[model samples]
Target: MTYEDLPTVPRAEELVDKAFSRAARAGRAKSGAEAQRSMLQTAGNILSDNLQNVTTSWPDFDRVDPFYRELADAVVPAHGDCPGGVDGLRTHLSEVMWAGRQAGHIRDEYQSKLRGVDADLARKHRKQAFARLADVTREVSEDLEALGEARDTLKTLPDIRADQPTIVVAGYPNVGKSTFVNRVTNARNEVASYPFTTKQVRVGHVERDHVRYQLIDTPGLLDRPEAERNGIERQAVSALRHLADCILVFVDASAECGYPVEVQLALRDELADRFADIPVLTVCTKADRSRDLDADAYVSVTEEEGVEELLDAAVEAVDYEIELPFEG
Candidate 1:
């Protein structure tokens, strides 16, 4: 489900240069029509294999986890010249695959033409085949560029494990969402920017009773309504819908967070309706400053008060059951 291991995508010109350069070396090792045939086969195989590798390196969109699939859809196209949507990305991949097959076909056809031909004629046919192969690659240059851009964007995404129970911490700006997550989880939270957005996301983990729970705090998403968000942010929230097993809707009852309690409650209600199947807990933060509002839990990160209790409540709400082996 992670894109960190995806291979770096090479440009069309790089692939072509590599293929032709190796073909020349392969040609030097033989004579007559054999030399020409060797060169053609060498170049063709390199181009075809490399081009195919680009496509194979990407996971099948249909089979990918819905969370990552949607995240990619939101992030990839926002940076580069890639077309929007998963379908558009698939189209670019299909083109690369087509070009790879074309390279193979060109090799086979030129090999046939080499039969019964002298060294000079064989050399001429090999050149023609090389030209055709390069042409095929050049035709899909934009596709290669788009896929390369996608690789760059997707690789930078924060590594959020889909297998573990996830608690998404959300609230308005300065509502102490990040502070609360930092307090509850380990000291080291992985922070990374979402592609095409100025805001960053923080992810942390807490282990209890031999099981791990993930806590993610995303800015610029889940803090505002869908109508107020841009396309990229909206899609990101959509992706979170698939990943969040439980959501902690933090409300700064003190109004010191710069947002009114009523507004925060409305957002909580909206999230509750949107993720109807998931547990949405309303937490009143900055308890030391003020506890003027009612919530499922209250916490003050500054004083380290009620934090553990809040964490226990979130973990219990997740209710993740670990499967045990059956007795023989």
Candidate 2:
């Protein structure tokens, strides 16, 4: 699921101000005890509904695709003041939800207290309820701020479609992975920065036989050894594991990418071991410059040579089957 549609989380002060302002208008429309009751109901309902909306606006982390779930966890800490994790984010949401319910309870209690009271007494009950609701809201202000930060971070994630057959390109920097992706896919390929990493992830698409395949080039996460990567980068790589149908390990045989062929091959073997369940193909890039390394396929983006064949190999490795409808 895409995070682009997530609603902006409202701050506590903003929510309180909005609810009370709207409640005043409702009170102006009525008279006496009824007016006070109307004002209380309006304000309470606004706070409860808005706080609940903030909680519900976030996609359930447990039910979300693992790729997005872990990626979000890596980028945003669960609590504004504590460490980051899915459970932490859930806790913040839970607090906000509880606050919403408390607002409703306060409304009901004050409404009950207003019964048989005169205009002034009813106004006093309504004011007390309003103060209580505001306090409840203020208590979860940190949670609200955390959710808002999460929304802002998650919304910026690259729109990678988990449904599509994905080919993850892995190699050292300047190994021609990006060049190959650009050459093979349409002009719609996107280069988006991950909030957790300084590097940018390039996503491109190619369609064949009416089925679309996504090519992803993740720089910092996949270009190095597992032990060399930081915790956040490792988590990011773990997230990619869920999206990869096929992994293309690009090896620059010419060593012009500034790494020895041996190092590149070692990374390939490491990935092969890590993603043993998925198909991992070794590709020798920069074929025009040198074809010294043995690989499953060879491609040279400079001459636009063998690029389509390599893409075809990745798709073939994916071996995605089209599901057909059954007729009884």
Candidate 3:
């Protein structure tokens, strides 16, 4: 699930306001003392319940798949706004929960203080109790705001399935990688005629012999070192490193994609070395305008040629991990 689907966490002021608003709406028709007690109880309940819900709704990083957990670990800690990373978020959230519980305790304590006091004085004490609760709530305003910021940052994360056999397509800019994915998977993932057209990873699914494979189309590669990669590219690299069962590196032989054959080869070599543990299949696109590329496979999307070969190679690369039933 995308982080956007996660529950919303209200700011401290908002929570306090809501709790007080609910308290105001609580019944006050009976004895003033009883009415004051009811309002405090209602306010405490509202505060505590809202805090509890926010804590519970957060994604449990411990229980999630490796991909998401790792992704969270990578991003949350790096968030400049979130002081404690994932643990920090947890700590802040825990503090909010504690504040909620304390608000309830404060209400109960003040209610007891109201026991022998006159109605007007009891009303004064109730306001004092709410003020104390609000103080607690306000103290953690930064934490609450940090949590909200973290949520916004996390929502942009791509939703990728960790259970499936996955293939990642990587190469320099404008190498027909997106088009290749569209043609092979029958998925209408966005395709444009410019470099870095795919700013985020696009996922598609195809079933070969009932064994599903997830195809990932990554943004265009840059001819630079990994250490120098920007945040978006680093995220792509992180996902690819953890999730790729196989990688398909494409090259443009005709130089129509702007980068020359040699530059594209350097990129392919770099990817092959980087993901040395996984199988890397290199395919030369733009075969119709071929200018001699020594690739493991070649495909011309415009002429609709060599696509089957590319698909066949992809299936074979993934099929190695598939355990077929033996006929004894």
TM-score of candidate 1 relative to the true fold: 0.89
Clashing pairs in model 2, backbone N/Cα/C closer than 3 A: 77-84
C-alpha lDDT of candidate 3 relative to the true structure: 0.79
lDDT of 2 by residue, 27-114 (tens): 9999999999999999999999999988888887778888877777667764646567677788888999999999999999999999
Greater lDDT among 2 and 3 belongs to 2
Error of 2 at 71 (Å): 1.6
Identify the superior model by TM-score, candidate 2 or candidate 3: 2
Among all candidates shown, the one with the greatest TM-score: 1
Whole-model lDDT per candidate: 0.82, 0.82, 0.79
Worst 10 residues of 3 by lDDT: 77-86
Which pairs of residues collide in model 3? none
Model 1: how far is 281 from its true place, Å?
1.2
lDDT of 1: 0.82
Candidate 3 residue 25 Cα shift, in angstroms, is 2.1
The local distance difference test score of model 2 is 0.82
TM-score of every model versus the real structure: 0.89, 0.88, 0.83
